[model samples]
Target: GFPGNYTDHTIANAAALLGAGRVVGVHRKAELPNYKVFDEKRYFHPGSRPTVVTVKGFRVGVLICEDIWVPEPVRSARAAGAELLVVINASPYECGKQREREAIARARVTDVGLPMAYVNTVSGQDELVFDGNSFAMDATGEVCMRAPPFVEGLYRVDFVRERGRVVPRSGPVAAELSDEASVYGALVLGVRDYVTKHGFPGVVMGLSGGIDSALTLAIAVDALGPERVHAVMMPSRYTSQMSLDDAADEARQLGVKYSVLSIEDVHRDPRDAGRGVRGAPGGYHGREHPVALPDAAADGLVQQDRTDAADHRQQERDGGRLATLYGDMAGGFAPIKDCSKLLVYRLAAYRNGLGAVIPQRVIDRAPSAELRADQKDSDALPPYEVLDPILAAFIEEDLSVEEIAARGFDRATVGRVLDLVKRNEYKRRQAPPGVRVSRRAFGRDWRYPITNGYRRESR
Candidate 1:
């Protein structure tokens, strides 16, 4: 097999040693991808052409990641007398990315009349995670063999000459991952590899009693064993006793090193500070809110409001002057920042399903910031049942206000939500990067202009 190279030196040498003919797709010069989630333009040049060769009395073609997605490369190989296509990919895992790959491959196979085998790299790489849902399809555009997602292993397949053409024998087809499962797996792998690859001894995170911190802690403990993870709870005067108890219970159940630090001395009520510190228009204090938590129905909105009223106290004191790395907000990374209010709850429940690490009460309790007394998320925003879907439509689906309102929401509400999403772009831009699990995340996928004046025309 030939790989993309700068010159034919390596390929020629290897072919001479093996005494076999080979085709190589190599960069004549350094090239780079000048688009989303890729900085390749900073690295290597583009290759010459699709590699086609003869192997085991069969003509075969080899293409790289970007090559297979387009039509010309596969067509070129077919013109060169290739009967089979082998595409090597390092495609990153985004929501529904695997489907896109298969669709592209199917189109190629359909056009070229050659059986295609698409192999992708698996495991996590920093902010990106790769899903190895490798598979092969026949010239008729049907999958012949499929490998499981997110796992790494070798799969064997037999090809036989039938009717003067090489045909792939049908084999095992692993079930595609469910939406929640796939996202969760991606997050776990992303955390694990990011921590390990950087050669960190362990990870430390603030385990506030809230859903975002709770889910983050669970992911951390799952990625790196409890021994390698540390959870700390910092309570202020506004912190509720329930939050304290729940935070403590979470640390105990997960079996991680836990510590409680009181920030009451330095904590000031924003109202008292009198700096007009308004609550940021988001869920649970600018943190990822939960999606469909298990006991979400059990703890009704009535309970949520009641609990919020009980927990509400004061605005979170602005920490611009006091922010420090070693203070209340000390951590190398923030895992759940991108999660929505409802998704955070859902992930916590999902993690608990594998084991009872997060206490049931934590999942069942109403979410609060605990930065001030009786401060419920609902105080500043609509209920998550209303907010999450709206956020999804705007942030992920790119729907207009009228379109969102047509989906049974108030026009004013939709308008307000969209405004918040736009106004908060600066905040999101400054926030630390988190795992991307949606079609359009706040990270690389989104590149909106901060000062744009384009308004959604009402229908």
Candidate 2:
């Protein structure tokens, strides 16, 4: 592999300085990959050749992340008398990525007729979460050992020579996490690391009585503990009493500090108050009442930062139109912003299972922005049950409108949903960074030109 500048020269110099011997390295490929989610071509020149070396009395093959996905590299390694395969990876985490890794490793080992040990990095870098699901597979394409996913540790693997052939000795095998569990764990780890590593004192989020906010609050508490998390309820004209009660109940149960700051005065200006979000001003107007705090001072509540409507009204009167939705949207972090509406419900259920924190009604109630009178999410978009899969197909799976419609969705509805997803690319880009759990999240993985004229209808 090319190590940036001076490649083999640097390695040789370092090896000589360290008194090393017999360092074999792969040549850089002539061409690099330039595709979705990858811009490798602009980086290092590709390795033009393969290399193998003997390590600890075993002839081992070394391959980088992308090389193992193709067959020719391993074939060349085996041709060079390699008895064992060791792959070093900096693979990013995606849905079912570990399973896919194992499956690919099994295929390579079966092709090369050798035991393989795969190593991967586990770190949450920006929007990318690298799951360390390193593993080893026998020549029979069976996983003999596996390191835990989303955890960092030193794992020891024992290999014994049996009848003049090296075979991986049975070792501790970590059970695969269920899909929901794996995703939930990734979210927790991602949030925990991001908040703590960045040295944020704590986090604050608007605690609407919706599934998205409910799930986000739970994640914040779980990641940084209730003491470091704060929830604010900014109610407006359309806010429901049930929403107020539920939000307060959830805050109390989670032991996170919360406050209710009514936006009633701000909502007096129907033009700005009717719409409660960033776009389409006057499209929504909602409010929720607050409950008395158990002990705001003791909970480390910052009084000056309270979601007081008077301050917002003053700011708005001073030509600060953005202040209208600031109380509801302003936050250091947002956990469920990346999550779809349906996924929000699923995550709420998942968190409650750990311990019933989110109220059942929050999960069961119809989702509404409460921006306008009697406005529900259904008023603006298709039902999440129908919309999520369609969105996933269009965005994640890259399915065309017809392809998605062929999966039992109405063509017109799929077309509409696709249009919404495409039109919202800019909004998603502007959203706060959250955990990336899906195969293709709205963050780094879902890059599309916001001003593009391309339409799925042509396909």
Candidate 3:
């Protein structure tokens, strides 16, 4: 019992959720993925149970995520007098997986001459985002009801009615949604549930007028509503008037409360703190490693003093690192804290172009952290179009430096980008968990040691 049966625990949990006489059935995952950062094979036993249970006088068969990927579960469910199939899954979010699941599950119903009701969980548990795209199909092989993707709802579908198999008569579900739409759905649902369940009424974001913040703000407004949503433009001197103006505009349009809190004061406070009663700057430095800055200066990159940099880094310097209380200050959670720079831009554009669209001023503004004077995102990061691809290769595909070089990226640029990503692992670790649309995410799917001594060929 030291290791414990996760399968048994899972089954029991389902039973509790459905309650007594509800005929809750738990199907364990028969196949496990255990390579390149996955180790499920080391944990639980392969599922052998595939029987149907009668719930409320309706015969139901339940299967886990991976079980029905093959044909055995469907065949067994039909063989067990199951007229309606209910699948409880914990499938991860890969690019086009929600649509694929719908196709695969619908086919199973048609192939077996039974109805299927699929239920999925959502949220970023480490690396994977379980998009709850629950759906149902009748015995005639027609999809009757589909719960929206990237959300969680306990709505009922008439699997069979009047003992005559009266199917659900809901409106047509949205089909052929864009990939971004699917990704956005997952993020919004995850945000909604996480905030609501955690007892947090709503969320707030530091809207920088960049795609990431815009998307995050939009998603937060969507999930928690404009009333609960809050936006803060923590602009520094380098933050363009364009960005600040656009950010403030989004808050107004959404009807969310907007605040302008300049981080310049905190940046200035730190330098004074270092010289005054706050003790020496080195006093904040204990167990600290110089990972934030590069040794060599190239491409106009220079070590802009960390005194006004990250409060977390400052805490680290003080031998006591702490995350900046941005969320706490605004009294709301951050929705897309872990979203990549490039995806942020694209998502911003997508939101702005939708329905009424975000104003052109927001999209046209340059990206900046607004930490100092004349600071541009290009000063801290490479062009997103260029940077995102390499990040996708390295983070999503797990490609190495040489492999990326073979893809026609400049070797020096690749090394620099890779280094920036690696060095910022600590920051990424501190970031709020975002939606995991890609195969490999910032946290779960991709993990490398932070204190590595290995150098790339360019070095």
What overall lDDT, based on C-alpha atoms, would model 2 receive against the true structure?
Answer: 0.66
> TM-score for model 1?
0.78
**TM-score for each of the candidates:** 0.78, 0.82, 0.71
Name the lDDT value of residue 79 in candidate 3: 83
lDDT of 2 at 351: 78
Candidate 1 local Cα displacement, residue 294, angstroms: 29
- Rank the models by lDDT, top first: 2, 1, 3
Tens digits of lDDT, candidate 2, 154-206: 99888777888789988889999877677777777777777777766667666
Off by over 4 Å in 1: 1-48, 268-330, 451-459
- Candidate 1 Cα RMSD (Å): 9.2
Q: List per-prediction Cα lDDT, in the order shown.
A: 0.64, 0.66, 0.57
Ranking by TM-score: 2, 1, 3
lDDT, model 1, position 337? 46
Decide which is better by lDDT, 1 or 2: 2
Badly placed stretches (over 4 Å) of model 2 are 1-3, 7-33, 269-333, 452-459
Q: lDDT at 396 for candidate 3?
A: 69
Q: In terms of lDDT, which candidate is stronger, 2 or 3?
A: 2
Candidate 2 backbone clash number: 19
**Model 2, residue 225: C-alpha shift (Å):** 2.0
Q: For residues 1-459, write the lDDT of model 3, one tens digit per residue.
A: 012256346321121115385625555555555654457777666666565776777777766665567777788878877767777776777668866887787678778877777777756553356776677767666667766756556767664465655355554453646866776776676666666666555554456665556666677777778876556666544567777777777778888877776655544444454563434533332101111111111101112211101111111111112222222112223345435555565666667666433666556666544444555557655676777787778776778888998999888888877776666566555554545566665556566676768845433
**Model 1 / residue 326 / CA error / Å:** 11
